[model samples]
Target: MDTNDLPFKKRNFANRFFDATVWDDFIYRNDDIVVASYAKAGTTLVQQIVAQLIFNSRDDVDVASISPWIDSVYPDKRSKLNLLEAQTHRRFFKTHLPVDALTFSDRAKYIYIGRDGRDIALSLFDHQNAARQDAPLSADKTPPSASGLKVLAPTQTSACDYFDTWLERDGHPFWPFWENLRSWWQVRMLPNVLFVHYTDLVADTGKQIERIAAFLELPLSEGRLPTILANCSLVSMRANARLYVPHGAGLWKDDGRSFFNKGQNSRWIDVLPPEMSIKFEKKAVMELGIDCARWMMLAGPVANASVG
Candidate 1:
């Protein structure tokens, strides 16, 4: 496919953490891999899986440092590009931008991991609470954040309150949830795009990892599969949680080791108000349509999944 015919950046996206235009300067390689997600949507999990596949189960792969978040405004543009250019290995990076916000390329493979919005909300609540008060803590001296938009640690006192704000404001402190998910969903059929839901990953991580491997054209060897699976597990990742956080710069509270929370589904089950649950479902359908909204919280026909 002609690179000219591929999807390029449609719009610039700036938020507290990202300057989407940062990707514009990147030179895409056909073998490059980009992991796309809307934060806390099993992104690190996918990265860990890809790292395992790429290294064929290297035990000490420091994924966060190696696979930099290209869209982030931190570390400056020159440094980010320089790191990528210097890498001799097949490079894979992470992004929180929607497909349209990205300088998309057919040359690169994109895998998007989505979770139930409710689950993401619950997960993010825990995540943001642990962040430094100044927010997005950086141990090193760094340039100002993207767009100079200052984001403080979340002030919401309760999980329910946080959910209300997250839903009402359309991912307020972060990016738009529906649009990010919808953006990837629209281009999901693209040859380079692969969509893997959180439920699917939770239900059968090994299978999902295999599917990801197939998509990236890097099939795992039989012996590497177990090691890859073990490394990508929540237990394994949680134990090494400090290594997975962005920059591993003590961005998280208490050394960022607790970054990986319970990797289960329906965390917002009985915790959310009945009306709030209804509100989320209605908005999800209205924003993402029935198919996607239904797909978002599929733990088994509303039996296992409360949000459904």
Candidate 2:
């Protein structure tokens, strides 16, 4: 299948959090790995996993610096491009943009991670709150561009209020949630694209790691599996937070540890109302169809579930 021929819409996503257009100038290499997610999913976790795989489970790799978020608008485009071009090692990058927003390359491997929207809402709230607090004193607080595109705003502290805003606004301060999932889901069968659910990672990390390794064609020695697994653990990631935290923890008020807060899913079960939870599920079904939605939320078996 020719991915370039796939239908896509060009968007000027210049928001406080993301800029989709930065991808237009990106150059793809045959060995490049693109780690993607809708915000606060397992993007960072999988980045760490991919870093370990590429570096043969080395602990000293600075993933955050090495794996820049290419689509981010904060760092200038030329600098990021130059940094990537200079890299000799197998380059892996992060992006929050959906598949359609990106410049797809058949040669590059893509790993898209998904999580329950409820959990995402909670995690996003924490991330936004911390980011807001970390904002520089002279930072621009002006409204986003006149393109009528809504930038991500500070999330409410109350879980219920935040959930309401997120559900009502369809990812509010961020881009649309359902469309991101649907866009990636439609291309799940692509040879270079892999779909990984957070639930699956939590349930069987070793299995998922092996799957990722196979997808990336990384040679995994049995001896290195333990180190890779340890580095990817929540505790280890938090402890070594400085190396993996985006922008070196300066973007977070409470430091990088707060950004890595509690990797556990379902923190929204008690907080999210039953009706709202049902609404999220129904919306997922409507957008992604029952099979994809079921696999996303429950990590159930899907037909022909090959990793790569």
lDDT of model 1 at position 53:
88
Every candidate's lDDT:
0.79, 0.77
Model 2 agreement with the true structure over 1-308: per-residue lDDT tens digits: 58665645466564566667667777888879999888888899999999999888988789889898887765666767889999999999998877767788877889999987788888888776766442543234323331231223355468788888888888875668888888888888888889999988888888999999999999898888899888899988888888888755755555667678777777777677767777777777777887777766663322222310
Q: Model 2 lDDT vs. the true structure?
A: 0.77
Off by over 4 Å in 1: 1-5, 132-151, 154-156, 300-308
Q: List the residue pairs that clash in candidate 2.
A: 152-173
lDDT of 1 by residue, 1-308 (tens): 66665666888885657777677788988789999888888999999888998887876788888898897866666778899999998999999898788888877899988888888988888877767765533433345532343334656578998899999999966668999988887877778889899889988988898899998999777778888888888878877876677766366666666677788787777688767877888788789877777877674334324335
In terms of TM-score, the best-performing candidate is 1
**Candidate 1: deviation at residue 227, Å?**
1.1
* Alpha carbon deviation, residue 256, candidate 2 (Å): 1.4
Clashes in model 1: which pairs? none
